[model samples]
Target chain A: MTEQFVAELRRRATIYWEKHPFQQAMLAGELAPDAIRAFVSNRWYYQASLPRKDAAIIANCPVPAVRRRWLERIAYHDGAAEGEGGMADWLALCDAVGLDRADVLDPEKVLPGVRFAVDRYSAFAREASWVAGVASSLTELFAPDLMGRRIEAFRTHYPWIDPAGLAYFEKRCVQAPREAGHALEVVLEYARTAEQRAACADALTLKCEVLWAMLDALDHAYRGHR
Target chain B: MTEQFVAELRRRATIYWEKHPFQQAMLAGELAPDAIRAFVSNRWYYQASLPRKDAAIIANCPVPAVRRRWLERIAYHDGAAEGEGGMADWLALCDAVGLDRADVLDPEKVLPGVRFAVDRYSAFAREASWVAGVASSLTELFAPDLMGRRIEAFRTHYPWIDPAGLAYFEKRCVQAPREAGHALEVVLEYARTAEQRAACADALTLKCEVLWAMLDALDHAYRGHR
Candidate 1:
């Protein structure tokens, strides 16, 4: 039954955000320079929000080993003492994309729609069962493939973007699978009941909605501009 | 200084939803029937979210007195049993506005923008300082007058609708002031330091933003539709 449930999760993964039009446009190298900048700026909000989401999960989870395992996610984004970690990589991407770091940092610069979506994502982590929260992040299961495609897409079509800025995606190529594997192990181990398994799938769907809605915000704001 | 901070919170209340254009239109009875239905439908999401927000506060708070006081909020919305409290009042409002009960319960019926905004509000209560969460409920301070106005508006302008549905607003007119007073006392008594007081005020501002954003979603979706 667990194996079947895993199959169901994989089936549901079709809605994973690689299918979002904005991501498709990026992978196809169809996004304009400004579109790329808008994407980077808006996505920065998600990257920044992630540490809080992970911390919320850790705070809610009962098991010490799970909490210890999850602690790395927060550290991965926030770093040891600032100016480091995945957040720093994102800022580098922002710089590489020619966005002003100050503008990227400004809360007002984030579209209301993007703020709404990201807040919902963080809220789900804070409110849902710990296993469900971990399940929602199984989007990482699909992330490595998209990251690889994104790296190649940027290199081939958007060559003007400094290759150094791609470090976030490149690192994620290694990190996401490892993280997803751990998360999957946790969810499979802990979500033993039928209802619990279904909730994990629903949580993943919610996460997918979050990602898709965020891109929808970007698409609305920058799709037609220039 | 706390008095001054309370004044600051009052001053910031200018952005409250009563000032939102959608509310302005509704008070003027300019909303079409469909607009009224959409408002009732979307606003139900906010109504349903309140109990969980209150529960999250109770869960996070250390003081038993505070927890005991806060528990009433969840009860007020959810009632002693399902289908008997503010949620029932809202479903009654939906029926009076010509919406199906099942439709209101259906998650898919909610607008993405409204869901995003409501989720953000719930998340704030779950994730912020317990005092700050209490402070956010300070919108109740301004809510009584709006509830009064809403009752008068529906009776005078939208008279075709059954007056029975107005029970929610009418109850709020009485309940809000009392609730707000308790919330203020908690904020004033517990938020002792300057930084904590500022955070309390900030939480109020965030709550105002949530209300305004919900109206914005309604305005976008039902503004022009007949």
Candidate 2:
């Protein structure tokens, strides 16, 4: 049943945002310069939002072991101190793409649609079961493949962007699968009932839709530019 | 100083969503049939979201008096029973607009942008001080005028929509000022410091921006249709 459940979760890859036309255009190097800036800048909202949701998960979880593991996820993106972690890496990417760092961090720079979609992640973590929160993080399972392709695409097509800015994507290529494995272990152990497993599957679908919806807004906004 | 502070909050009317072009087009009765549907459909997300945010404020609030008062706002929207209240009236609006009731309630039908903007209110309510949450609800101060005008607009321009569907607006025209007055008393009593007053002002701005941003997404999506 667990194997079948995991497989059911994997089937959702058919709708994974990696298949999104905006992402496809991105990997194919067809995105305009402005579109690239828009992605990096707007995406900063999601990058910046990660640690808050992780903190929510930690706040809601009762188990020390679980909280300890979740703390690492927060630190992974937030780093040991300010100016250090994945968020900084994303800001660097923004800088590499010629977007002002202030603007990237500015709430005004984020599309209401993108902010809406990303805020759902935080709300889900705060409102759902801790196990379900972990399940939502299963988007990591699909991230590595997209990261690998993105790195290659950037290197070959968007060579004008500095290599250093790609560190966030590069690190995720290694970090995501490990995190996904950890999250899957937690979900499998806790989400034992058929109903719980189904809820986790629904959470995964919500995560995927959150991502796809973010791009839907971007695609709508940048259609003319693209 | 309190009068000045209240005056400052009132000044935000300039940026209130009543001024959004889409809203302007809406009140002017210039919106196409498709635009009206998009407006009603997407506005449902915001209407539906109101009680949840109010609940967040109530949950975070320790003051029973405040909670008692705020609880009324939730009941006002959600009604005493499921089939009553503003939500049911909104479903009627949806009916008037030709959208299916189930589709109006479906999370999938909501624009991510609209959802994002609306979700921010909940997050703010959960994360900020209870007093700040009341300040955020100060958008009620601006709602009655818009509601009155909206009723007139629908009666004058879009007579195709059933008059019954306008009940939500008609009721809010009476309800909003009373609610806003109560919220202002809370803000005036609690936000005594200049810094606290400024934060309340900022919260009001955030609420205004939330309303504006919801329309931004709708405007972008239905621009050509309009």
Candidate 3:
């Protein structure tokens, strides 16, 4: 079964090879209209809904200290109107992508999978223990690398995209590491036994799969396969 | 946004590459003590929850003809008795795997992401049009191929895993193609507008991603990565 599980993972991972080199060489000046547009549109679910998932995790947290920290982090990501948290900054990037503010705000065009995946993540957090919920978010392990490549690539390959369009990536660079670190600490500290640790590890992997799956849907639906 | 989505998918797909192929190659044969144990243990979610997802889709069906057909299909999969349906058959496979039936039924040990992904999938179906929901289940497009390979691989590589342990896959051989055909017809017949066609395509992609994501998570949590 473990092998079965891993085989499954390998099959999914093979799809990501296409995104390399293209998304990796960036810095700030490299942003493109299309690329920025893609980022804004696709990341909307994550940017907008991540905190909600966090909130669910916080709500379910068995540990008060952990819950408090998560709530604060959630607030930080979802800041007060304008100039605040990640979402607004993400919009600026959306503008960089040429999407009208209204369109971005309007959920009509958003893909259904995005809605389900983000909501489901939050729901899982709501339903499961906070330890496991937090453990599942370990996809941040790849975020820093992905974010770093994105920044460098944006600066390098697609310069027409305004520097402002890079806001989301920049923020992720800052936020993802902090969030990942904190979430991992919680997992390592709180998951007390082998089974629990394995579970935690599984949770994190699951998160990665969710992210990967969303991307796969996008690629298949919108890109070369389509 | 498309590129990022694709990028993310690629990343998840990469994680799947790290599985121990040798073990997976053996997963289909006579039950190894380890493989059987893993199968029974991990399969709980697949057995326990798939019908719920199907029910959600069925509940959302608006067309009478479609609803009736789906209902019959659901019954066939779910069975009338406590120990019935494709899911129950899956559990019998679990027994073949090594898990006590009691533990296999308890969802507590299932990875939180698996629960979220599968539940999210069903929720996506229930929330959308019957056509759209049916479209989302095109993974059958890929299933028969995988099942055939699995059956043959098990026959050749993992004879320790009894053929009975693989009855689930055997059943899927007939089941998936029939279901996929029905679903494909639903989408093609109902999706008249270009946007609807696009949506149908997106739905199929989303389903694939769900499958892909599940696999990716397994790889991350169980195998080669951090």
Give me the candidate number with maximum lDDT.
1
**Shift in Å, residue A17, candidate 2:** 0.5
How big is the positional error of residue A48 in model 1, measured in Å on the Cα after superposition? 0.5
RMSD of 2: 18.8
- What DockQ would candidate 2 receive versus the native complex? 0.01
Question: Worst lDDT window (10 residues) for model 2 chain B?
Answer: B59-68
Error of 1 at B202 (Å): 18
Which order, best to worst by TM-score? Answer: 1, 2, 3
Predicted candidate 1 versus true structure: per-residue lDDT over A123-207, tens digit per residue = 8887799899999999878556888899999999999999999999999999899999999999999999988999999998899
Docking class of 2: incorrect
Off by over 4 Å in 3: A1-36, B1-226
Task: Give the range where candidate 1 chain A is weakest over 10 consecutive residues by summed lDDT.
Answer: A59-68
Return the interface RMSD of the candidates, in order shown, one decimal each: 14.5, 16.2, 17.8
**TM-score quality measure for candidate 1:** 0.54
lDDT of 3 at A19: 45
TM-scores for all predictions: 0.54, 0.53, 0.44
DockQ, candidate 3, comes to: 0.01
Recovered fraction of real interface contacts per model: 0.00, 0.00, 0.00
